[model samples]
Target: MNKPPQNSAEMPDYLKARRLHLNGIITLMGDMKKLNARANKNAKVERLTIDAIAAELDLIDLQLKRKCG
Candidate 1:
């Protein structure tokens, strides 16, 4: 009989951190989407804030992949 493959559930601290960071980025993106839907064109500040958040999320995703890989 063949044994089941091992899971990465036992990953190290760094991997865990990366996973958490990725989750945070996703959550932030969801929030930004909601805000964008309600925000009017005159809301320049809100648009800028959303743009910054998106940039940060991209950076975090890249960092997480680098660290986890």
Candidate 2:
């Protein structure tokens, strides 16, 4: 069976921004998961680790904005 295509909603600017931010977080999380799987202890504490941490923080901020605004 074939699947139906998704429709694009006319979302507000904030919602669009939130979606973009959340997508970025998901991508970052996936990258982090891969890094954690393949990397040793030293790599875990590198710049990529810091980037993932910052991405998590940004995700939290976006979530809060979504909830509060």
Candidate 3:
């Protein structure tokens, strides 16, 4: 059988997955930003969620920078 994913649980493109992931995070952040600007937005929860997603994106960036050799 083919080798299973080593870097992520669902994504198999180890080398380029970060770009994909960052794009997704960026999209999510944009949506959250919009929500935060709305009248009914929960400020505290939005702040926490955005912070968590940002941290996860940073980790993905760090992983992408690691040498494969």
Top candidate (TM-score): 3
Poorest 10 consecutive residues by lDDT, candidate 2? 1-10
Question: For residues 1-69, could you state the per-residue lDDT of candidate 1 as single tens digits?
Answer: 233225544333544555466567668766776777865565676557657766766775675567467
Error of 1 at 48 (Å): 0.2
lDDT digits (tens) for residues 21-63 of candidate 3: 6568768877867766766556777568767867877776676
Error of 2 at 40 (Å): 12
TM-scores for every candidate against the unseen true structure = 0.44, 0.39, 0.53
Superposed on all Cα atoms, model 2 deviates from the true structure by an RMSD in Å of 8.9
Question: What is candidate 1's TM-score against the reference?
Answer: 0.44
lDDT of 2 by residue, 4-61 (tens): 2243232334444655665676678678768787565666455576677567667657
- What ranking of all candidate models by lDDT puts the best one first? 3, 1, 2
Mark the 10 consecutive residues where model 3 has the least summed lDDT: 7-16
Model 2 error, position 24 (Å): 0.3
Model 2 quality (TM-score): 0.39
Candidates 1 and 3, the one with greater TM-score: 3
| Best-fitting candidate, scored by lDDT | 3
Please list all clashing residue pairs in model 3, or write none if there are none: none
